[model samples]
Target chain A: MRGFLVLRVVAKLLMPFMLLFALYVQFHGDFSPGGGFQAGVIFAATVIFYALIFGLPAARQLVPEALVETMVALGVLVYAGVGVAGLLLGGNYLDYFVLAHSPVHGQERGIFWVEVGVAITVSGVMLKIFYMFAGRQRSAEDE
Target chain B: MAALTLGIALQRNLYAVVVLSGVYSFLMATALVALDAVDVAMTEASVGAGVSTVLLLGALYLCGGEEAKPLTRPWLPLVIALVIAGALVYGTLGLPAFSDPMAPIHTHVVPRYLHDALKETGVPNVVTAVLASYRGYDTLGETTVVFTAGAGVIALLRRIRRRKDGEQEAP
Candidate 1:
């Protein structure tokens, strides 16, 4: 129990920094070793650590299962919706050059939105899986 | 390396085998990354290193880690795997050299991304420009693949819980 508390405290201290780093990587992926994929993993690892130490029930209290599911769907929707937006702008699907009035700004706009989609989807999937595994053990204990 | 492979195969400890398999897959993924197959490497890191390891351990727990009987047809399987691997290596000999400057892949459609990607796309990374902008539809499909896997896992876990619940209620 004491070990678990120590882990929980450590995780609490480190999680914010990890999440900040994840965002840094996500935004700067255009010029870094980290991208949406790596940033997603790092973000997920922090949450998983929280769940492991503080218990899945507590972690779920922090980020509910329903929210995670919704985030997953929302992420994919954002991605597909961007393409549809491009199509609506009279360009080929996913042609982001015309996503805005200016081509340069439009590219940045598209990249930002798409990276957000990736981050959301990846983080949602990770949490959902962790919930599934950890939920099992929780219910077993209740029984 | 041969001895390590043999040891992993012969090990009765499933956890050790799983860890070894993870290491092996990570190495393969690294090679793919070095070969400029970032998409494949990403998939390997997520599915191979992350999900597969979790699923294998879950299975190990649920199904008791009993060692199986020794394979009687190992020789045949080995010969078949060797033959397949040989065919693959031979086929690679006719393929374009990696990063060949004059190759059609480097000269054609890909070159547009390599050249105009920075000025036009405003993105420093050509791969990102290609994946998220130039071929976003493919990425949409990939995202859907992940969503489906997530759904499948949730459904499987629910089924398992339901079965356990039924067994509990029976008493």
Candidate 2:
């Protein structure tokens, strides 16, 4: 992988835009046809692209397995945490009306945070699955 | 589309099957967009065409790239598929036409989602507003389900290898 100079250079040139597109999909989801799920897949696809062009170790160094695993849970926690926050803010469970001063703003805010959580979890899971398949037998076989 | 799908089902080469499936997914996404379901279109394109192909290739790397030869004819599967397709088409006969505004669900449930979604959630996409705010509990459950699925796979697949130097997965 390191020897594929053209691939390495092309991947380097492409990754930044991939990352930016993922972000665009994430934030514009509320207005556009995409939301967290699609955005997360795109984001994970970008990371997986990098791993394909570079080595898995390089990608793993960039995003530790530990962090990815944590992200898998943290997303759910964040989603549920928002619901709890709604409750603590004097509304029912998962209520967005109490999340901010105005109910509309609260709804928007809640959706935003929830989308973020979803994005994090989905991307993490996708990467973890890729890593699990690529890592274990791979390293042993490589050496 | 049928040609691509037939190529996928009939191809003995696992790599060609994967590639054909990717093309099938892209076509499916285009069809979804034509149906005015852009959200679903995006998901189908990204998840189906992109990552899953790579994942399948990775799996092929471990196992042999060739699919195993079947000992018998695949007639039973063909019959089953035809039966299921017949049943599905029969079922669809009773349903409203595609994108029919007068359809039951459209008349019953979708109006409010389309009308009040923006005013209620300040989100322009009715689908997002419905998923995130109106059906918030379901979305939360969906997220939890995704997390649980990931955890389940990790539990099943993660092997603690005993290296010579006592190396380990990071905590």
Candidate 3:
């Protein structure tokens, strides 16, 4: 708390790269050593870092509580919706082979959307949990 | 690794225990890398070592910094733990050697996945192909599980917050 200036400056310097690296991990998952889960966690960690430095209210303004809850639901819907699309296309549930013009493209497209869904849900849940815990302590103090 | 676990077990201070547990997670992540499970390693390093520690520290803040010393000698729990450990170690002896290509799992659906994942799924990473394409339903189920857990926590907290508000209004 004493050296607030140093912490703030360093956090500002680090956050963009952290977010970028998270994106890299998210997209490069098909070829490398990361995926939705890791990327989502890293993204959440960056935001949590900002919250720690700037305060929870600032973080909440940046990512509103309502939006976070919607994200948790929306990601699941996106994931399940892809499966329903597959079923409508005459494939079985979650069958990606018929998603596009060819099986290869379809598979890629399906995987991409699925991973995106995973990342969204994971990140939203992480931030939501953090907010609950941190917010609980704050409200207790306010009382 | 054993040393870290020992330290965590022996540490009387709750804060030190939390930090040591995180260190153990980091070490587990490193070991996963050596095993060539890079994706899992990344998950462990980030989720286990990073986020869990912060959450635990938040919990500690609510509770207190120091652990309350248990007065009773924990003989029964210790014995149960020892028995469970022994059973687990015994169970491991039945597993095939590490990376044994001829193992039942490697010879099973894994062959089909390894051979056809890239050709059929258009993904270079077999793990991604398996998780998102071949086993898409399972992944969907897992995502739903995550959603439910988050919702559960949120619902629980919201009620308490509302109750608190009601009390304040009563005043």
Candidate 4:
């Protein structure tokens, strides 16, 4: 596989486009038929594709396990923080109306941040699962 | 689709089953698109077809490529499945027709959500407004679940790596 020139070349060429599409899906979600979940999976798929072509170690180097774990926790914190911000601002839990000067702008801003949180958590979870399963088999074979 | 299901059911090869499952997910996504659930279709296509297939293939690498023979007789499980299927079919008989305007859902808070979503939330996508604004708590919970799952996997797998490192150090 390391010597497979065609696969290496094609995967390198396609990875950037896949990532760009994932970002597009993430940002355009409010207007389109995609959102955090779909975008997260697309992002994870790009990493998985990279892992397939370049090997697990390379993928691990690109996104270490510690960072992935942080992403998972950070995303939840971001989401909960937004809710607490609402509470601190004299609104109910998870309330977005009080997030800005205008209720509508506040809602939009809250939703956008919430979607970002969801995307990060979803991608982290997907990558964690992939790394777990893939790493387990490799370690098992080593023994 | 029926043929694909039959082929999946009849096949003993786990690899073939994984491939067929991916195909089935793609078909399900197509069906969702036809039903005007584009968001759900996108999710199905990405999670079901892309990620799930890769995960299953990774799992298959660790497990046997072929499914093992069942230890017990199949008739009792078959009867249970048929009974549940029959009950599900019977339950559907009491449901409203497709796109029934007078349905309970259509008559409920959905109408309000649809009418005032844009005005109140300033989000043009009603689904987004409802999911992120109206039901923000639920979305937060869902994100927490994803976080917990990742944490749980790390807890489970990290111990193995720690043990391996200890073993190497001892040797």
Tens digits of per-residue lDDT for model 4, B36-92: 999899999999999999999999998879999889869998899999999999999
What's the lDDT for residue B171 in model 1? 38
Per-residue CA lDDT of model 2 for B81-111, tens digit only, reads: 9999999999999999977878899788788
Q: Which predicted model would earn the best TM-score?
A: 3
Relative to the real complex, the DockQ score for model 1 comes to 0.54
Q: Fraction of native contacts in model 4?
A: 0.80
Interface quality of candidate 4 as DockQ: 0.78
Q: Name the better of 2 and 4 by DockQ.
A: 4
**Candidate 3 C-alpha error for residue A129, in Å:** 0.3
Superposed model 1: Cα runs more than 4 Å off: A1-6, A140-143, B1-7, B25-55, B70-76, B168-171
In DockQ terms, which candidate is top?
Answer: 3
Candidate 2 C-alpha lDDT tens digits along A1-143: 86889999999999999999999999999999888888888989998998888889899998899999999999888899999999999999999999999999999999999999999999999999999888864765866
Better of 1 and 3 by DockQ: 3
Candidate 1, overall lDDT? 0.77
Q: TM-score of the second chain in each model?
A: 0.75, 0.89, 0.93, 0.91
DockQ of each: 0.54, 0.75, 0.87, 0.78
The weakest ten consecutive residues by lDDT in model 2 chain B span B159-168
Model 3, residue A89: distance off in Å is 2.2
| Clash counts for all predictions | 0, 0, 0, 0
User: Model 4 shows how many backbone clashes?
Assistant: 0
Q: Give per-residue CA lDDT, model 3, range B61-156, as digits (tens).
A: 888988779899899999999999999999999999988889999888998998988899889999999999888889999999999999999999
A8, model 3: CA deviation in Å? 1.0
Model 4 alpha-carbon drift over 4 Å, by segment: B160-171
